[model samples]
Target: MNTSILFQNVKLGPFELKNRIVLPPLTRSRSTQPGNIPNDLMATYYGQRSGAGFMVTEGTQIEPRGQGYAWTPGIYSPEQIAGWKKVTETVHKEGGVIFAQLWHVGRVSHTTLQPGGGAPVAPSAIQAKAVKVFIETGPGQGTLADPSVPRELTTAEVKELVQLYAQAARNALEAGFDGVEIHCANGYLVNQFISAHSNKRTDEYGGSLANRLRFLREIVEAVSAVVGNDRLGVRFAPLFESTTEERVYLGLVEEDPHQTYISAIKILEEVGIAYLSLAEADWENAPDLPEMFRKAVREAFSGRILYAGKYTVEKGVRMVELGYADLIAFGRPFIANPDLPQRIANNWPLNQVDPSSMYGGTEKGYIDYPRYAG
Candidate 1:
């Protein structure tokens, strides 16, 4: 049988993926309560989708202070590590490679999600606009609330956050993950530092583009130190333009996204990380990353590159054929079809994802997604 590019083996740094299809980081918020630890349900969910070439766990908080949404898993505590052990073991048994996405919401968090009811932390003291954080109001019920005004992190505190990221990498290793991916996109803490509109600090962590990239550089360095550069990955959401108000969620579009991302990928090149994950706008009519930006990414980074954002099988194969993207991640499709890669390969029908069960839910939409019968 002729193999599709999506099912072909590809080298990503020191590791070689069995295929080119990836299950991108997705927030299901199904972790156990009290500690927001991964549970059996979460493990089953990941295990069922182990057919993908690689899988990245949902945005996991590096520390308690890193949390912004209720019920999302964390990598800090011992219990959380134990919980993730079950998940990683199951996926590994199925011959799956998985990475943990270390995340911090920064100013995009509400006081309820903060420790001791404190404000969220950011490079500058600014309130995020047009974003809502989910808070658990009761069992099986959550509501979105406006984020609190964040306080600027002091220089010492910024260094501490770097340590936190490194520690999370260690925890990821303990939890049995093959690697770790730094969440530097989607208006999160790292994104805040990268954006001129969000980072208004006068310190070394802000100002020029180099200064703005300092935080990301520090975190990447620290994390790479723990997980090894060859096992480290970075994710960035570079939007060129927003056709409507939804574009505001990620932050102001960079004047030259090509140059901005090329420079960022250059940092990854120097760091010698495994791969770079670029998340494009997923909304309807959203533009794909420009051809120039795609070439710039390939030229700047020597390692593999993964792209996600409403990707279809044909588009993914086209990107791979064009040498633009090494791997393609399917998000919503994987949510409803645990056997997405196999389904695509055999031309089988896919299950439709229920948007209502996306955020926080039980076994219904979490692990009950049936595999292809054919």
Candidate 2:
């Protein structure tokens, strides 16, 4: 594999990517409490990873009812806006471009995380299995618990959610983000609506594949109107597992994933969006995404395609060389090595991440990971 290919600059919509390396959105629940607001610490963490060609922020809740995890930042409040302003400014000062990932966890949440302690909302009154939601038990303390059953949304509320997504796009721009990515993957809100197992709604928003994708189309269209198609992107985690493997929590393997996701990408292509991020199933022994499916995605989608899973420098360069993906995202590796791109380019030693301090911690594991020793 030609390692240099990963460092080459490429055009990504209106803005040019400094390299083919991307920093995908990672959820580190460290925002200030009482009000889920971004802080200086969060800004420091992102600023450290500015070497990426493009970076997407952690899942930022679009509204109060959208939050599913404790201490994850929201985009609806004035304080949240100001707090994120610091982050955008810091990243920009480091010569990096950043995008806000708009997110809603849907039924994969406990009632404690919902507004008024209400049951989380979904396309149907179903509970997500195998995954646990983080709930704040006390000051600076949280616990993992089973998700609660959700309440089905009325047609009117679904319409309002479309408006909410648009407003969140406006908020992201107000907070100084270069663009926004709709988080329609990982069995979250949009994914729940799209999945046949999670959604049993008999309304226009469910039933057929086209009907199931209606909510996603509406949010993408609504968000595009605000951010413009050139500045918008969508992320879809299409899990393709063999029959031998057990179904995972975040990525529910679809019976016809190729059709499901290619159709989804076609919608984005018609809208003329900036890029599409396809997150591969990242679990141990997860079957590799089929080459035929990859080739089909490249042909079906017109925009740039970015991929992330458990990618190494060699594997990433090979993917780009094989003409499958345009950009590669380093998730956990970036977590441990802030100057990850530089280290890879120079073949430098990397730091190992502290598993214990990975989620909801102080700056210990966040920004304290040093660069390659000289």
Candidate 3:
């Protein structure tokens, strides 16, 4: 099969990517402790994978309360900003384009990860079920625990969160990132507000579909003011009932995912953002997105669309050829093979990812992944 389409340049917002392959945001939990700051080790990891046309950093929390997992980096502090600067600089040196993924976990967090051990905040007072959050137990030690029951965010606080997202975008730009992608997917803060099951608010920020999307619309506009719309992207994981129970834990399966997400995509389209990324179910035996839904998304949104999750070269090429996706992100494959694009180009054998060292560790499974020897 012809894989050349994956190597062709494509326009994304104001920038033109070298290829259509993307390095999607994958949480490695390797940030430096005490402040969750990015470090040189992380810089090395990204630099090694700079061959991709586009790359997004691991989900970097916009504020302290936004963290649900231990040791994930943040974009809220000056020191943290400087740390990320090193990462962006490294990628730039290799002539790679990178974007910082601004994130907030909402109620999918334990109290230990919150400010003053306070309850995690959400659109409503609901505890996330069937999910475990990673928390630091000690220096270089951590364990997964149940998410704490969350308190409802006041109307005023919801507006404040919008400004926080804008500030995070400013931070990302200051750190020399090419752009920023908002983590609005996978049961994170933004997704919590969008999911009807998680958001039971009666305020203008919830209830109706438009109201539920109000938070997202405001955030996209707010962040776009700081970083132009051409440099802003949003990610969404629209889960359906077809997903297995275990895989659906990250984001609640919506009753009408197609209608819900199409409405959300329309909002992004209205704002004229650079791109929209949709993360599909990645588990073995997981189903592909419905053809009807993909077609609907293409008709609803005019900007570039990205799809990630278990995409092989052939599948990615087909999606690009079919015009369903403008880019394909390879997550775990890029994790184990830093020269992933080259491997795909050359048909080289790939190194299997070491699952044990996937997160919060020394640079064993990270930068140590060697390129093909042949």
Predicted structure 3, TM vs. truth:
0.99
Candidate 1, residues 1-374: lDDT per residue as tens digits? 23377888888766678899999999989899899999999888999999988999999999987888899999999999999999999999999999999999888898888889999998999998877788889887888888899999999999999999999999999999999999999889999998888989899998899998998999999999998998999999998885665534456567676777788889999999999999988888787778987888888888889999999888888888889899999999999999888898888988999998898878988888888776
- Candidate 2, 1-374: lDDT as tens digits: 57899999988878888899999999999899889999999999999999999999999999888888888999999999999999999999999999999999888888898888999988999888767888998887889899898999998999999999999999999999999999999889999988898888999999999999999999999999999998999999887774443334454667898999888888888888999998877777677889998999999888888999888889899999888989999999999999999998998888987888777979989989998879
Runs in model 1 lying further than 4 Å from the true structure: 1-3
Deviating ranges (above 4 Å) for candidate 3: 246-251
Q: After superposition, how far is residue 73 of candidate 1 from its true place, in Å?
A: 0.6
Instruction: Candidate 1: give the clashing pairs.
Output: none
Task: State which candidate has the highest TM-score.
Answer: 3
- Candidate of highest lDDT: 3
Better of 1 and 2 by lDDT: 2
Against the hidden true structure, what lDDT does model 1 obtain? Answer: 0.89
Native-to-model Cα distance after best TM-score fit, residue 236 in candidate 2, in Å: 0.6
Worst 10 residues of 3 by lDDT: 242-251
Clashes of each: 0, 0, 0
